[model samples]
Target: MSDLYDNLKRTVEDLAAPADEQEAMLRKARVGPDELALDFDAFAAAALNLVESGELSSEAYEAVRALDAHLVAFSGANNAAEWTEDALYHSSNWATARELASKVLSLMG
Candidate 1:
């Protein structure tokens, strides 16, 4: 496992970090809506591309994709309280993203 759960557990504890830190963590893990800020389909495209390049296995992509599905499913379930300093709410989908990201990270190694 990549210790992503532990890392994420640590990250989520504050839930009030500046948006940059949160986004950095998500990008470093190659997961979450944080990437959507850079490009609409960037996150999703990267996973499949990684799989295709044999960088990330297909199994990992599926787990990542499930997280993406949650991002899609809960696209409207925004909450005002979790908004980072940058003004983007973390959303309930973040939990789902983190859970699935942890699973994918665990499986990879």
Candidate 2:
């Protein structure tokens, strides 16, 4: 249970991070812009699984779901290549994602 919480916390924190830090963390994990949406989807799946198994609250699940929706939409509008660390500073989409992620992080806590 602690491990599950910890993992979810870490993922939300990553999403909640500033653009530069999020890019850095993703780069460190070898996850580039092309895979960013997939990463978010994975987070949603994990959160949903926890909720279904009665390990997480509906509130947390909703938080994750909202972020997932925003990010996936953002992905559809922008080229994955534009997700580079350099481009993130110029992107409104990244800003929105970070905002939603921060909200999710706070709600999860």
Candidate 3:
């Protein structure tokens, strides 16, 4: 578990680190009102693709499921700021997502 955890953490840090091309693309994507805004669907698709490609393990799927439940709860809240705070700092969903991501990274390594 520790080996998996460490590997997963390294993989996520590498992937999450903004590369120049990705950064530029994100900047461009955010530039115009007409530009297609980044959406959760796109992110989910990418993650799913990783799973399909064998880059991520089945553990990631479980984590994502848990995270989605948390996101649903967060979305139902009235206070947007509070929801954001909870999602980022206090939600079990976020923890699950992190755990999944780490597991995936470990598998990749």
Candidate 4:
């Protein structure tokens, strides 16, 4: 429905997508010296969507932003391993999201 969603879907589709499109997604998410920012576009969009849905608190949203920033800060760095570890930090943030989601569902019930 949105550009980020479309781009993300194409990425998930991977082998099913046209070769050129898949390559494009990989290129966007690829690490390189010329890169100016991390490619967390899909992850950020999905997280914001949930926050916009009123399922997560603003503080939780900020936590996600912080994690994104942590990874983005390494955009210009040459170490791929550090970038990957920062990206993996999403797991802990997802746990926070799950806790928020549970609270929202409890309130709903």
Best by TM-score: 2
RMSD of each: 8.3, 2.5, 9.0, 9.6
Candidate 1 structure quality by residue, lDDT tens digits, 1-109: 1334333323333222444666776667675544442332344445555666666678867776675565456444464333333343445445455566567666555
**lDDT values, one for every candidate:** 0.50, 0.71, 0.42, 0.42
lDDT sort, best first: 2, 1, 3, 4
List the candidate 2 regions with Cα displacement exceeding 4 Å: 34-36, 76-78
Q: Provide the lDDT at 13 for model 2.
A: 72
> In model 1, which runs have C-alpha deviations exceeding 4 angstroms?
1-41, 77-92
User: What is candidate 2's lDDT per residue for 13-100, written digit by digit as tens?
Assistant: 7766777777777789887754555655665777777877787789878877888887767564446556677766777877777788
Q: 45 in model 2: Cα distance from truth in Å?
A: 1.3
Using lDDT as the measure, the top candidate is 2
TM-scores of the candidates are 0.48, 0.76, 0.39, 0.36
2 versus 3: better TM-score goes to: 2
Q: Weakest 10 consecutive residues, lDDT, candidate 1?
A: 7-16
TM-score of 2: 0.76
Tell me the spans in candidate 4 whose CA falls farther than 4 Å from its real position: 1-41, 80-109
TM-score of 3: 0.39
Model 3 residue pairs with clashes: 8-106
Q: Identify the superior model by TM-score, candidate 3 or candidate 4.
A: 3
